[model samples]
Target: EKVAVVKEEVRSAAYKANVVKAERDALRLSLSVQETTQKKQVEQLQTLIEVAKAGNQDYSISNEESIKQTLNVSEQLNEQAHAEMQEMRAKIARLEANASSEIQNLEQKVKVVEAVLVGEVPAKRMRRRVKTKMKAAGV
Candidate 1:
């Protein structure tokens, strides 16, 4: 019964790990899409800046500032995504370790139980005491 419970717990942990992995993959895909979009925007901004320079048009200082701000925001977002991925990876590692430890403990318990059941564990002391009690009772 206890072994079954342990098995169930192991299964639960494995399922949770897979769920986390899927979430991580989704987050990665989101970040990748965001990165591509940001890159396109940056390239378009750079082209506009170059065209303004070539045409001798006075580029608005506000435009430059806006580009800088956008780049900064993108960097921040990338950093945040990277940190979140790291955290998820760490969580998965911890869960795997816990599951492994639980399995080892369960295996050890099963081994002991099997040994006891198979009479590999010594029962001589108990047998001796029981025999003494039976002799005293004149059985």
Candidate 2:
């Protein structure tokens, strides 16, 4: 009977470990997906800028200022995207580190299996962070 109990405990620990690993994997996967999407968007912005530059050359001088402003806006967008991507990468690194340490701490706890048995999976990963844009002073 003792042998059976020990075996069950071992299995529970293994299951918890697997779940923790899966959670970490899911987190990392999400960051990679976001990075890929952001990279593609940056590429698109570059193409748009190039197209705008070529278009500006063909426009009359009277429209030159407008095209130049458009080009400037496109450049600003590219810079902003790159900055956001870098910030996101930093966030992923921090989150990954925290998750690894959390998993280690959780491994030392004995009741993880009960949580598992009752289907109490952690839902923190599903939360989305929202950033509201602030309006400029003039528009």
Candidate 3:
């Protein structure tokens, strides 16, 4: 019974670990997509700036300022995203470590329970039986 309960606890911990891993993977994929989109936007803005520079001076200057502002905002957003990703990575690492520790502890408990069960009659029972037999034998 104790072994069964321990096995169930182990299974629960494994399931929780898998769920956390899946969530982390999904977050990573989202961050990657956001980065790719940001890069494309920056490339497009650069191309526009080049075209503007080759055309009108006044128009180019205004567009340049606007582009600079946009670039700054994009850079800020990217930095924020990076920070969030780092924080999430750290959180996942901690969670993984905790789950690993819990699983190890549970496995150890299961081993101890199995060892005790394998001994058939428990040590105390065997000792008591020995005493009873010794008394009967007038020893």
Which predicted model would earn the best lDDT?
3
Best-fitting candidate, scored by TM-score: 3
Q: Model 3: number of clashes?
A: 0
Candidate 3 stretches with Cα past 4 Å from truth are 120-139
| lDDT tens readout by residue for model 1, 11-126 | 76667656766766776687678668767776776776677667756778787787778767767776776787678668767766766665555555554444444665467885
* Alpha carbon RMSD to native, model 1: 9.2
Model 1 clash tally, residue pairs: 0
Go through the candidates in order and give each one's C-alpha lDDT: 0.64, 0.53, 0.78
- In TM-score terms, candidate 2 sits at 0.42
What is the TM-score of candidate 1? Answer: 0.58
- Judging by lDDT, tell me the better candidate of 2 and 3: 3
Query: Which pairs of residues have clashing backbones in candidate 2?
Result: none
Please provide TM-scores, in order, for all candidate models, with all chains considered together. 0.58, 0.42, 0.81
C-alpha-based local distance difference test score of model 3: 0.78
Q: Give the TM-score of candidate 3.
A: 0.81
Stretch of 10 with least lDDT, candidate 3: 130-139
Model 1 spans with C-alpha error above 4 angstroms: 1-56, 123-139
- From the highest lDDT down, the ranking of the candidates is 3, 1, 2
